[model samples]
Target: MEMRSLDRSTLGPENGFSQLLKPWPALNSPFKGAWCVVAPGTSTTRHAHPDYEIFIAMTGEATLSSEGEEITFRQGDIVHFPPHTDHQVINDGAEEFQMYAVWWDQETAGRFLERHDGQDGDRDGQEG
Candidate 1:
């Protein structure tokens, strides 16, 4: 079994947040997993990709913007993002916002979308 840590020292800045666990051939994982942290008053870039993604809020609170709507979430909340939808997250709280994210490959997302009748299961997106 492979083991990894989410320690701050292991993360690097990407876009506008600190993240780690990016997918690579050496990882041998089917999907990408990341530990992300957004500082107060910061936000991630609004972006989209052809992969399905989900985020688990681990600390603080933030507002997620997607498909013309803003949703607020806090620790213990989970959010899903459909492929190709533009989305961004803003940390308005005083503390840092931390979350765990996972996303599947495009081929896997395509198959899942097909099974779901092409209706986007969720209306948010994220950058790898």
Candidate 2:
């Protein structure tokens, strides 16, 4: 991924219940980028990215966990995870959850994303 401003046009729609701003990243571009926002009371299926991911919440709250620690995150909170690590995001709020996720491949990139086709990921619903 190349270095771009916060207003990257290629990033599609906002993700969550609110007007979530993604400004997402490109594939195999040599950079990891943030794909932002998940709706409140909703959640993305548990999963892992090929590059390290960072979750930033600007509004509402979220239930996020890695390993055995489960925590709720609110505004001004930033969560970081390394590649291939398990992570889950759950919107526990009543309103929309606005978030920004920044991913990096070289640990020096503006953003990067490794799409997992439901292979290696956070599977909260598929567990025994």
Candidate 3:
């Protein structure tokens, strides 16, 4: 597996996506897509992955949910989920939120918005 360390500067304030990691630049179809995500104390705008996903929290504590139920994850916790799993997270700890989210495709993102209250999550990062 080809692996590359993502520099910290690569992450910045993003629309909807607080932090982002473009592991797969789309040039390589069927790429192993991965992203670094960070959420503040407040809840993130609900979203989803069009493909299978894996979330790795780098630091701090967070509450992630896929329906009405929420699961709390401390530092070093890893979460594995399937495609179309509508989820959202918030960092409750007194620090910046950080997590690496891995997904398979752009369609997976749409499933996130579908689970929401009919709110379309067609933001910039994924499909428009």
Best by TM-score: 1
- Please provide, for model 2 over 1-128, each residue's C-alpha lDDT reduced to its tens digit, 9 standing for 90 to 100: 35545443433442322222333343334443454556556776677767777877887888887776899888999888988988777777777666767666664443222343222343544322
Q: Which ranges of candidate 2 are over 4 A from the true structure?
A: 1-30, 107-128
lDDT (C-alpha, whole model) for all candidates: 0.78, 0.61, 0.61
Query: Which candidate achieves the best lDDT against the true structure?
Result: 1
- The total number of steric clashes, by the backbone 3 Å criterion, in model 2 comes to 16
Give me candidate 1's TM-score against the actual structure: 0.74
- The per-prediction tally of clashing pairs is 0, 16, 5
Error of 1 at 109 (Å): 8.8
Q: TM-score: which is higher, 1 or 3?
A: 1
Q: What TM-scores do the predictions have?
A: 0.74, 0.57, 0.59
Model 1 is weakest, by summed lDDT over 10 consecutive residues, at 119-128
What tens digits encode model 1's per-residue C-alpha lDDT throughout 46-116? 88988888989999999999999999979999999988988888998899999888889767555554544
